[model samples]
Target: MFQDLDATLKALLDDAAGPAELQAADVSFDTPDKDYKPAQATVNLFLHEVTENRTLRDEARVMERVGDGYTSRMPPLRVDCTYLTTAWSAQAGALKAAEEHHLLGLALRWLSRFPIVDDRFLRGSLKNPPQLYPLPTVVAQTQEGRSNGEFWSALGIAPRPAFSVTVTLTVEPFDQVEDLPQVESIQITSTSIPDPTLAGRVLDHALTPVPAVVVTVVETGAQTTSARDGTFIVPGLGFGVYTLSVQAPAKPVEQVTVTYAADHQTHTVVLSGP
Candidate 1:
């Protein structure tokens, strides 16, 4: 990693217009003493992110360290540069031969403290070394409580909240996405019985269905109503058993069948929320 960083730094230094002497060094973290291992915890970096106009004032503390530590500090980060910062994790137990096996993973963060717009450092002057973004938040998802079987168990249920995905993109303005029209339908799912008593307040997990809720009868291709409280009544039906499905945005699909009674068919299915 040092070799790669050295080569990249050299490449950028030669391309610079000015004749400024640039030096590179590595910053390390200590645990009371240098020999102790920092296992499975917040690796703090008490680093600075200085820019031309403004700077991130807050100081962050971190534990883990990666080989490619300071790529965004110099080089192509000159001015008006736009790039993505990626993070990696390493197993901290053993390097060569003997060590205890531990699930201790460490976080690696690459930040762009200075958001380059043009040939200009939006945060700092292009003349000096750039400061990477102050807070490179890594989502710490440890398998602390849940077992491996829980993940596998999700598959057994017909339509259980199985998996989640998150995608992040840096854009000039976030509202630009709201303007786009719905050529394709996006489904957000939630349970019909949102609250037993509370009227307005919704649990943090459930989403208030926007546009409308989509209820589809698989065999007949029939669609129905979307009430203010998000309920649809299916009527004029003979004695039949069918699977009813409901879904919404960024939510799990829910399916439960009901045998319509001759008098009244009132059935409710619970979607495991959040």
Candidate 2:
């Protein structure tokens, strides 16, 4: 992947230089140290750093349907590749500085015009397999936590006029993709629920309506109290036979058997004693 990026950068620079005098200058990726030297005018783009672009990081997985199954894979990793761009001229004295400065200026101008590396300039794997994402370019930007003076000093060379270029690229995290079988059919089932209710009244042996009596269904343990009108209601019961237990103040409990039906009707329970 790094090699592909190098080739792509070289191609872009070549296009930028076009058929002008700068076209004859060699584009090198070699480390520029004290011992480094070029025979003619050259543009040195040293790949100085590579780091993941966390802001562009994606954790989602991509899925595609193929034949009878679906293939899924993690999203590609995005990384920023930083390059230290410097110009070199074989000429000496003030002429050398002038030519180097001119070359650097032209390179910077051309690179700045492009926010993304054009697809036509891509080479090698970047072109053959085709890129999934656009290559975003950042020209002449200050690198975080990097010092140009220290970089030159570490290389045992004097500080020179240079700029940095960063390009964002995507890398596939894995080659293997998971395959899932396609679902052929779906089934759904539903059931009808019955909400039957029981309503009744309580009375004493004298055939007078009795209030404040507790009415309970012995089978389901459902209970309700008779209202001031001596009527009580119990909802959410299914169609079946249920035993009603009626009890009033200072009276014996009375048991009445009744059948609950879809067509509801009030039943009367008469206590044996007053």
Candidate 3:
């Protein structure tokens, strides 16, 4: 990922800084020695530090559906890579300082134009596999590299003008995960059972049918009173075990468990009491 960013920056500089070719190299802050000879201009991108973007940190695990099971994986980690960018010139003369300063200005302008590097500019493995967003780029003064005095002192070199570039990237986790079971579809089976009809007659002790006797299904709370003929019928009830309750005047409550059948015929019950 760092290599990709560096290459992209180099491409941008080479395209913008015309006439003189600029090469991006991983070098220290100390100016190149007299024995070393580089192109007319060089952009040194020194990766100095890396910091985690805590705000992008997430505790929730990522889940994906694979076939009949779900695969779990850790969330991607976000980090900011800081690069110390220093422009150099091979020319040695009174105008060498001015030439290096001019090259640096051009590099800064070119970098400023791209606050974010588009995905098309990305190369290598970064172009495929894990999905990533356009990298955000920022050229600014860093607290650690406030001045050339302290910055160059840390590198054990003379002071020189330089800027900081930070590119934020999202990196996937290195761990592998196993797929787990997940419910895909639920199957419901229905039988063509006949609806039930409960019918009963209420009678007094004299064996005469008693009208107005309330017959209720205890499970469903469905009740019906006997007609003038002392007969009651409840239809369209599902086939199941139910408690049939019979109540009339001057008679104690009676309850009986009846397992309804699929015959679709009326179930008859006879009740007689005081």
Candidate 4:
């Protein structure tokens, strides 16, 4: 990817500084060194640094539907590529300085006009199928609190006029998975649950539990006898409204209404007069 970026920048410079014939080089900043021949003009673009563009971070993963399955992939990573671009002319004296300045000026204007590298100008591996998108180029992006004096000194060359070129590249993550199953069809079946339950206590006028009282559901003909505690529970009744009659010694038939649901239902019956 970096090589492709280098190619793209060289092509742009060549086109802008016509006839000067600029070529991208991997040489040090010092132009007078043996690495540079004092023969013709040269444009050196050194990839000084690279860092991830944290601000452009996106969703960690993305999903795509494919036929009967889905594919998941981590989103592409964005990186900032920094380049130090300097120009040189082989000849000495006024002519050399003039040529170098002219080259640098043209390079600056060309890069400034193209804040984004056009798709057509993208070269080498960038033109490949995998990398379909064009990289964004900027001439002098803000590098907070940083200086290049050490950079020049380390290169063993005196600092000259140079421009910083920063390009943003998107790299797709390699971790991807395909062919996860999807829902085919949904099958739902009807179920009849006998959950209805009737429960209550039989009490006399004295407010005391009356044991052995019989409770009957008139609609369903369901009957139950009260236990020692005067409580009766009729389980597994169907859902519907029902009338219940309580029978106790010397007690008139006390009528009560009950609405049974899919859940338990309760009704209290009181027996009084003889």
The digit string of per-residue lDDT tens for model 3 on 90-205 reads: 67886778767776776677777778876666666556654455678889657664555655666666656778888788788658886777864443323244444655566566
* Candidate 4 residue lDDT tens string, 65-96: 89877887777788889888887887789998
Residue pairs whose backbone atoms clash in candidate 2? none
Model 4 regions more than 4 Å off:
16-35, 65-69, 130-133, 181-274
* Candidates in descending TM-score order: 2, 4, 3, 1
Give the number of colliding residue pairs in candidate 2: 0
Instruction: Tell me the tens digit of each residue's lDDT in model 1 across 1-274.
Output: 2222223323332333422221121222221122333342212221112222112232232222334231111111111111111111134434311111111111111111112222231222222233333212223222268443543343242221111111111112112221222233343433233222101111123344333445556556665634555556654445577766666446666666666554424554444565
Candidate 1 — worst ten consecutive residues by lDDT sum? 100-109
Clashes of each: 19, 0, 0, 0
lDDT of 2 at 236: 75
The TM-score leader among the candidates is 2
RMSD of each: 22.6, 18.4, 17.8, 18.6
Off by over 4 Å in 2: 16-19, 183-274
For model 1, the local distance difference test gives: 0.31
lDDT of 2 by residue, 135-250 (tens): 99998889588678889999999999999999998888699899877866542322233544578777677666789999988998999999886778887787788899887978
Point out the higher-scoring one by lDDT: 2 or 4. 2
Per-residue error for 19 in candidate 4, Å, reads 7.9
Which pairs of residues have clashing backbones in candidate 3? none
lDDT of each: 0.31, 0.84, 0.67, 0.72
